[model samples]
Structure formats: structure tokens, C-alpha cells
Target: MQNNITIRGAREHNLKNISLDLPRNKLIVFTGLSGSGKSSLAFDTIFAEGQRRYVESLSAYARQFLGQMDKPDVDEIEGLSPAISIDQKAHSHNPRSTVATITEIYDYLRVLYARIGEPFSPISGKPVRKMTVDQIVDAVLKRTIELHSDPKEIKKRKGANHNEIFVMAPAIVGRKGEYHQLLQDFYHDGFLEARVDGKIVSLRDRIPLKRYQQHTIELLVDRVPLGWPIEQNKGLQQRLTEAVELALERGNDVVRVILDDGSEMLMSTRFTCPEDGFTFPEIEPRLFSFNSPYGACPECNGLGTVDLFSDDPCEACKGARLRTEALHVFINNRNIVDVTAMNIQTSLDFLSDLTLKASDAKIAEPILREILSRLTFLVDVGLHYLTLDRKAGSMSGGEAQRIRLASQIGSRLVGALYVLDEPTIGLHQRDNARLVETLESLRDLGNTIIVVEHDEDTIAAADYLVDIGPGAGKHGGEVIATGPMPKVLENKESSTCAHIRGDKQIPYPKKRREESKTFLE
Candidate 1:
């Protein structure tokens, strides 16, 4: 492969017929007066050709959607690669677009939560789980075996006359109602017996109850012998399956087993609290997405505000932008909202100190790695003060460009051409070196970086310098000097070289204006 990009007879815009050779995998800077054909050479001719070539390589169907790029007026060029341009343009104006979405950190977070997040019941304050029919059957069979083999259980049950366990559904819990109609409905549904307020009673009998008193009702589904090997008996297995299904349906996904010794065990076929019977939907990646209808808060519509122009938080989701269920599903005692609410530095600290269960860690390893890498890159680009949930439209042009730059670095792509325009425009002097260092790191990863900048720190950090201009616009289409900074500095004809050598300086004005007392705040 060629180690340089060779251009011949490139004429676009104000650029005169020019030819140049630019080094590959090196940090290159184009410096000149405003409108001096620097952008014409770096963007119009070079980057344009790269984009055109890439679009051309795609299928015809793909080309139509992307539109077409007009080829640059270059005689010939060689050794071009895929090009990515980062300029000082607002990244997005949509209120829905956020920093986390642009960097794809939130996508990984959704997957992480879906895979390992545990749902805790809002009503009972206990962990919930969903089990398959086969899982419930097998668990019950295993539990029976464990009990039969235990000497303590055997001794405790020696005096018990009954060897049968009851599978019951908690139909009603602590509700104030006479339930006369409810009992009639249950009788019509073929239920024979129910334990009312801890006392077993026949549903067929007219049992009167006080209307104002709180009552608990348990509907009996089926009974299994304690010593029966249900795992080996097909009839017993089928009966148990039907019983569990009936109990789950009657109890809103919950079932209870009363052992012969009077011990009770609770199980659920869905993510529901056994005590309160509050159920949650299946866990999926979409469930954590605030942009999707399935996961977004119903009242706020995932906007976090009822009014578009308002700063007040939504009354329902309370600014979380996710449904109640999504907020309740947590990992390491924090939900997705909690993590995204933190600034980059705080997020880094939180994730660094996070501890996960062994099983959860195994599933979350890759996702955590990606999220941490992107967050670290954002911090590296001097965005440690920004929150992941901050609206992208609210950021300054320089901040948006740096964010895109950080996302590009996090991508870790190699063998590409990156064109950046004035990346250090609005950055503080203290952060300039870190930006330069980030660009250098990108170059070290085998990418070619071409930056059109006038920042002294950026220019001093360049590996190759191209100065295009005798002047701006019409007078400046030609490359005045192209080489290492030291060699380019030797060229006295170049204005940038003259300035760099201290031959030209912007002197302070000889006259000063008086301060005015009147001012607009």
C-alpha cells in the first residue's frame, strides 16, 4: 500500500491548478489567512473525493438514499481512504437527541440493564422473577425430594396424618368486600373450596361475611401426595402443570404451595410480587429505551416535560423520562436514569466503584467496557462537566465538534482519513494540550488527521504543515509551503512562517477608548 496521498491537478473553488503529496498516518495541519484555499484543498478536493469514492463503492440502491456527491475537478488522485469530517457545526437541534445517544453509550446501557437488571416490586418491596411452567414443575419436584430426604422434616411430620400438599392461588388479599358475587363467580368457574381469612370453607356453601372487614381469600387448585415421585409419573406431572397454570392465572402470576408440615412456599410464573401480586412485563432491551413507546413514561411521552419550552420536570416520571417499571428495575442499586443523570466525571466515578453480583458481572462485562471507554474519551476531550442526558441542541458548536471527535476516537477505527476544522476554536487554553494529545492518539492508531486550524498549540503539535496562501480568496489558491514546521518556517515567502518566526505581530493599539457607565445586562 502507498504511504502517502498523491494529488495531481486539483482545481476546485478558488484553488488554482495544484498538486501535492500528503503523508499518511500522520497529523497534518493546514494554516493560512481566512479563505486562503486551505479548506478548498483539505475538504473540497481531498475529503470530497474520499466521500465520493466511498459512496460509489456502495450498491446502486444504497446510493439513491444517500444522494450523490459530485466528483472534485481533479485530474487524478491515489491512496485515498474513507473520510470522516468533524467541523464546528451544531450536532443536532432535536430535543430528543442527547449526548448519550450520539455516542451510543445509552444503547449499550439498555442492553446491560435488560440482561442483568433485577426487578423489585413497588408494592411489596421484594425481588421479582418470571419462571416457565417447566421450571416451576421441576422446582416443586426438587423441593419435595429435598424435604423427604431431610431428617428434621421427617421427624416434624411424623405425627401429621395428612401426607398431601395444597397448591393454592391467592385470589384476594386484604380487601374490604363481602365477596358474595365473587364467590358465586368462582363456583361457576368450577372452584369447589377456598380458604377464607385463614379458614377453609366450601365455596358451594352460602358463607356470609362482613362487608366492611378486610378479608383474605385463597383458592385451592390441586393437591399432590408428599412422597409421590411426580418427576417420574406422567399423570402427576401433567396435573401439577395444570395446577400451576391455574394458580398463576388466578393469582395474577403468583402461586403458593402449602406443605404437609404447614410450611408455605411462594412462586411466580411472571415477574410479580408474591405478597402484593403486582406484575411487570418481560425484560427486554426496548424496555429501557425512553425513545420507544414500550418503555417511555406514559404521562411525559419520554420528554421529561409536559411543555416543550418549560424547564419544569414532568409530574408523573419526575424528569426520569422512563416508565415506572423501567425506573424500578435496578443494577447495583441504581437504575439507568440514575447513571445518565450524572456528569461525565461523576459517571466515571460511579461506574469505577460499581460492584455487581458474580452472575451479573459475567453478562455485563462487554457492555461495561464499551460504556467506560466512551465516557473516558468524553472526559479526555474536556467534557467532564457535561451530563449524559444533556440535550445535544443546548451545546455550543465547539462542544459539539469535540463530542463527535471523542465518539470517533471511541470507535477505534483505523486506516481512515479524518478532517477537522478548528477543533480548538472555543476551548480553554488549559484544555488545548489535551485536544492536541487526543488528535495525536488518533494518528497513532493508524489514522491520517488533517486539521485546518490557526491555534498556536495545534500548529506546534503538527507532524506536517501545509500553508496555502499568498492571500485569501482569489489571491490564495496555491500552496505556499508544505513540509515539517522547521522546513516550512525556512520559507520566508509564507505568511504563516513569517508570523511563526516572530517577523510579524499584532501590536496593541496606541489609543484607548474611555469606558461607558451605561450598559445592557
Candidate 2:
């Protein structure tokens, strides 16, 4: 009949007969100094007990391999839901786990892009100059050279044949090198002008290009011949088939004599080769190469950005700029040379002071802003001034920790508990407010947040606060206070009471911001 979750005789770690009642579905923060058994009570005790009980509930066969959690020293607990924990461990891993990849938003976006994107051909459009009407008419009459390789041997079933000739043309023709060369030499210099129906054209006079379409640019022939051979020269097969059917103007079968090139052409409606029993497959347009202009953007390969050599480092860092393994112990994400690159000196000196509208370097203002914006995400998450290309492997514990946090900060999940650890450890006083805002927003989403924190800023934002330390180690573990923010601070016996009520210096405001109040007239 207790009002909420009854945790009676929870002797987990420093918890001494901790008969506590935790309200369901509320933000409850546990606070105390380091080693005050905050993690022991939350992690080693309640979470451990929950896991043990859940696993125990499963069949013996299921529990055999899954292994239940080792029992925590706890008597009883009620009204416990499943738990989710996110610890502060820097996963300096492969870029395979980037912000886009982790949140899965990139995958979703890819589906949207591929489904609705403009499916332009990978090839560029080349130029086709305006040809005079006479010029185009002349071009149509020029060399009607066509060649087809012999059909494969297996296509000899003699089934009704459906041979057709097709020319592959560009979807959009423009002035490219190949098309220009076609007009040069061949338009006038070659024997085409004479063969093109006596329609002579000079490069000088302006003739309308409309005449080009008046004559056929390309033609197709389809007819069947009875005496097709079973086998022949592989290259000469199709030509012979076309010539035979073209030359025979009787019985809907036409055959033509071979051209001097030792090949037959497939033109005119009448044509079938000797052995005429095979059907051919249709050919479709193909992408050259997605990576090459063949199929993708030459600049970004459809990825939208190219990697600059500078952005990718030398092989030493594996292009990471940061060495793969830090041989010596560095205090944080910074090593000796990182000292130079991390231009912003301290937590207080962070970029927030740098105006989005101001700059003082050789780089242009826009460029500086771009650089700072990306690097600032790292810093705002306590990763200031680090280059965008900094390899993940060399990131410090806190730097990597916060970087992972950044990837998830934009999650669309509205009501999922985001249990955070000491989120303010590496952050300076200025960053505490940002951290506080992040937690408060998560709490506002109806999630039951439970933070094991030591930061004063994080502690103050909680809907309900629990202090589990009156001393350290064995001397600690008792619930010193559990109540609303103000009431917890008012508790005479709470260890955190003095920390909040105690006089502490607050930082000077960056700028005294006061909005003008509108008065109702």
C-alpha cells in the first residue's frame, strides 16, 4: 500500500536498509560526490536486480546460456519497468559510425532521394551544330555503312525470326568533341556529299537545318531468308543475313550483294541472313560508371562532396591527422601538437565569444564561420577547436563521449528516457547551462529521466532529487534526501544541501540580455 516503488532493505553497496519510495514516471536524479555509491545503487543494485529477475522469469533453458545478473544485496522492489542506461564511454571507433549512419536518418533520406530524384543520364550532352537544309539532306544520303556480327551458334532453332537493326542515339545532343569531329572532314571532305542524293551543300551558304529531318538519319531492316547457313564467319554473319534479304525483292524476302568491305548491310525493310532461325535480344542504355562521370556526379560521385586531401590526412594518421595510437599519456583529446590546432584556449574561451558575424584571420569571414561551425559542434559537446577530419581513434574519453552524444541529440524519439552520466565533467562553467537545457528538454518529453550526476547545474534541473550520501564509501549509501528541488536543498541532513544552498560564485553574464516587454495599449 506504499505510495510508490518500495525499495526496502536494499543493502546494495553503501545502501544501508534503504527503504525508499520512488514515484513512477518522474525525473529522479541521484546526486553526491564521486565514490559516494551513486552508481552502485543505480547500476549494481536496482538494474542488476531487475536483470536478474527478468532473466529468472524466463525458462531454465533460456536462463542457462543468457546468464542472470549476479544477485545484488537487495531485499525487495516493486513497480519497476525495464531499464535503459547510457554510460560515458568514448567510442573512438571507425567513421562507419557517423552521425548520419547512427541515427539512421541518412538511410531514410537515401530512400527518398533514389525514389524521387531526377534520374538524369550520367553522360554530358554534346553540341550538334545547325546544318543547312541542303547540308542535312546531303548528310542523309551519305555512306549507309552498317555491319552486324554473326549470331551465336545456339540461336539456330529456326523459330520465327525477328531481326531488327537499331541505332543508339543520345537523349540530348550538344557541342562535345566527338560530335564536332563528325561535321568536319565527313560533311564535305569525304565521299558522303556525292552519295547523298546529289544535294550539294557548301560551308558558306546558310541552308536551313530543317532539311536534315526530311531524310532518314538512320534506318532499320527486318526480313527472313530460307537458306541461312548454320555457321559462318562470326563477324560476317549479320551482314550476310541483311544483304541476302535485301537483294531478294521477291516473296517479301530481299537480298543485296556484298559491299566491297566484304560485309552485308542491314537496311531496307527486306533482310534475313542465311540460317535465319534466331531471335535477338533488345539492348538498353547503360550507365558508364557510377563512380566515373559514367553514372555519377564527377565532383562528388553522387555523394554531394569530394574529399580534399587536406581534409583526409597523410597515411601517418591514416589521414586522421591524429596518430592511431597515442604513445604517451595525454591529458585529454589534445596531444602536444593539438595544442596549436585547438586555438581556443580554455573552456571559457570557446567559440561562443567569436561572432558568427565577425572574424580576425587570413581566412575570409564565411570560411571562418564554416570551419568554426563544424569544429564548434565538437566543442559545444566539449570538443572545441578540433578539426573536422580528426580521426575517431585518437579522440579522448570525454571528447569521444560527447561526440557520440551529439549524434543522438537530434533523435526524433520524443519519450525515451536518456539516462546520462556526469555530462558536465569536461565542460566549463559556460557549458553547464547547455547541458542543463539538454536534460530538461529530454525530461519535458515525458521520459522518466534518471541521471547519476555530480554537477550542480544538472542537479538543479531535476523534477525530483535524491542524494544517497552522508559520507564516503561504507559510511555513505543512505538516502540523505529525496524530494522536490527546493525541499531537497532545505533538508538539514542532505550532503548536497550545503553544495546548492552554499554561497558559490556565479560567472558574469556573457552579455546582459534583456528582451523588451511589449505593453498592451
Candidate 3:
């Protein structure tokens, strides 16, 4: 394999027939006076060629969606790999796009929450869980046994030695309608009877209902007598299973069991609160995503704000950007919103210290690992101060670029060329070492990194340096020196070498300005 990127007669923008060989799999810095063709060489010529070659390799049908790139104005370029450019441009301006989402940490987080999250009822604040057919059947059988043992409860029944119950499906709840057509449809569908507003009525009869008044209707699925030993009876259990399944299907995941003693129980195949009659849909990864319609706050439509360009949070979700149901789901006592509300470092700490139930931990191991890796990468890029939910558009150019860099590192792709623009910009001096280390890590992963940077620290950390210019624009675009740091610094023609070598310096102000006493107030 070719170990160097060979370029000859590369003329793009202000570049004047520039040609050079950049080493592969190394941290190479392109530093010079601003507008001295560093970008023209790194981005326009090299990265552009790499991208165009990659796009061309795709199928003709796939190429239509990507659109064709106009080949750069260069001749005889070789040894180019697939390239990705991480520029100082916001990847997305959409308010819903955040650091976590961009890095795909939120995607894994969503799956993790959906798999192990415990949902609590908003009304009762009790853990809500979906009931399976076997579970509901078992519970009903237990209730039948208890009822049969109680003579006082059985005394109310006329000439009955066993407990009797009705398995029904609630077709409508607190709905104001005559329901004439609904009854006719059920009657034609072979349903003989229905419980209308707490009274059993034959569906064949013309049940009078006030159209303006609220009513509840439950279609009778089956009537069973718990006389014989039901637990040992296989035939009875099979019948009960069919009835429960039918009831759940008609009731939209809920089934109601009514006893002859006037007591009732609501069973569901969904996460439901028995006391409040609240039912949640099936838990899935999409439910935790604010971008999904099923999970987005209804009041703000998932934007986290009711009004535009204002700090006023949505009254419903309180800027959590999700529905009340989604917010109510928790893992280790923290909801997805609560987790995303924390900064990167805080979130990393929380995840590192998070304790899960044995079963839940088993299910969430891979997901947690992925989230942690991405978070650590963000921290490595000197972005520990940003929140997971911070809008990507709100980040500064340098911060946004670093976010993309962190995401690239997390992707773990190899043998690709990565071009970065001034990753050290907007970063504190204390955090510069961490950022440089991150670049080094990427280079060590067998990928070539070409960074167009002006920071002396970043320049000094490069394994190879290509200093462009004697001056900016027309007088520039020519490589003054290209080699390792010592070799570049020794070159007399390179203007950047003088500044780096301390041959010249920006002197401090001759005199400090006096503090002004005037106040606007």
C-alpha cells in the first residue's frame, strides 16, 4: 500500500500549482498565515478528491441521491483514501438535534431505556407493568379460589355453589354517543350481550342511551363458572386464555373481569394503572425519542418551547421535550430527560456509577458501554462542559467541530483520511493537551489526520508539518517548508517559523488604560 498521499499540479482557489506528498497514518498540521491556501490544499484538493472518489464508487442508483461532486482542478493525484472533513460548521440547526443525538449516544440510550425502564403511573405514582395472558389467567384463577372459599360472598348468589364471572372488553369509556351503530355492529358480529353503563343488556334490544350523556360500554366476551377445580383443568385454562385474548383485542389492550358479587378488576396487556385506568402503549426505542411523534410533548410539539426565541419553557413537559408518559419512565430512578439534563461530565459520572437490577444490567450492558464510550470521547475533545441535550446549533464553531470529531472517534473507522479545521479554537489552554491527545489517538488508530490549525501547541504536536506561505493570497499558496517540526523551524523562508521560534513577538501594550469611573446608570 502507498504510505504517502502524492499530489502534483494541484491548483485550487489561490493555490499556485502546489504539489506535495503528505504521509499517511500520521498527525499532520497545515499551518501558515490565514488565507495562505492551507484549506485549499487540505480540503479543496485532497479531501474533495477523496470524497468524489468514494461517491463514484457507489452504485449509479445510489449516486443520484448523493449528487456528483465537481472534480477539483488538479492533475496526477494518487494514494488518496476515503475522507471525512470535520469543518467549523454546525452539522444541524434543527432545535431537536443535540450533542447526544449527533454522537448516537441518545440512540443507544433510547434502546437502553426502552428495554429496562420502569414506568410509573402519573396518577397513582405506582410502578405500572403490562400483564401477559398467562399472568392474567393465573391471577383470575387465584381470585376464583379465594371467592369460592368465602361463604359470605357466595351467599348472595341464588342457588349457586360456584363463583361466576364475566370476561368483558371495554369498547368505549366516558364517551357521549348514542352508540346505536356500534351496538348493531357488535350484534351482527355475534356478540349477544354488552354491559352498558354498569348494567348487562342484550345487544339485540334497542338500548336507549342519551346521546348527550356520557356512557361506558363493555362487550361481553365470555361467562365462566369457577365450580370445578380450575387450576387442574386444562380445558378451562384454554377457554380462559381465548376469552382474555379476545377481550384484550377488543378493548385495545385492556380487559375487565366482573364478578357476580358486584366487584370488578381491570387487566391489561399493556403497562396500566389499575386504580387510575391509565394504559401505556408498548415500550420501544422510538418512545424515548423526542423527534418521534409518539413521544413528543403535545403542547410544544417536542420543541421544548411554547413560543419562539423566548426562555419560556413548555408548561406541559417543562423543557424536557417529551410526552408525560415518556418522562414517567425511569431507569435507576432517573428518566431519560433527567439524564440528558446533566452535562457531559456529570452524565458520565452518573453512568459510571449507575447501578441496575441484575436482569436489567444484563440487558443494558452493550448499550451502556456504547453511551459511555461516546461520552468519554466528548470529554476527550474538551467538551465536558456541554450538556447532552444542548442544541447543536447553539454550540460555537469550534465546539461543533470538536463534537463531530468526537463522534468520528467513536465510530472507530480506520484507513480513512480525516481533515479537521482548527480543533483548538475556543478551547481553553488547560484543555489543549486533552484535545491534542484526542487527535493523536485518532492518528494512532491507523487513520491520517490533516489539521489546518494556527495554534502553536497543536502545530508542535504534529508528527509532520507543512507550512504554506511567504505571504497570504497571491504571494502565498506555495509551501515554504514541509517536514517534521525541527526541519520546518530551521527553514528561513517560512514566515510561521519566525513566530514559533520566538524570533518575533507581539509586544505588550506600551501603557495600560486607566480604569474609568463613569457609570451608565
Misplaced by over 4 Å in model 1 are 130-240, 243-270, 307-312, 510-513
Instruction: Put the candidates in TM-score order, highest first.
Output: 3, 1, 2
- Candidate 1 global TM-score: 0.74
Which sequence of candidate numbers ranks them by lDDT, best first?
3, 1, 2
Q: Write model 3 residue lDDT over 237-277, tens digit each, in one string.
A: 88888999999999888898876564677878878765565
Looking at model 3, residue 356 earns an lDDT score of 85
Summed backbone clashes in each candidate are 0, 31, 0
Q: What is the lDDT of residue 288 in candidate 3?
A: 86
The residue ranges of model 2 lying beyond 4 angstroms of the native Cα positions read 1-3, 50-67, 90-95, 116-395, 399-418, 503-521
RMSD of 3: 9.2
When superposed on Cα atoms, how far off is each prediction in RMSD? 13.2, 21.3, 9.2
Write model 1 residue lDDT over 168-259, tens digit each, in one string: 89888766889999888888999898889987789989989899988889898877665455448777677778898999889877787776
- Residue 142 of candidate 1: its Cα lDDT? 68
The true-versus-predicted C-alpha distance at residue 309 of model 2, in Å, is 19
- For model 3 the TM-score comes to 0.77
TM-score of 2: 0.47
TM-score of each prediction: 0.74, 0.47, 0.77
**For this target, which candidate reaches the highest lDDT against the unseen true structure?**
3
Candidate 2 structure lDDT: 0.46
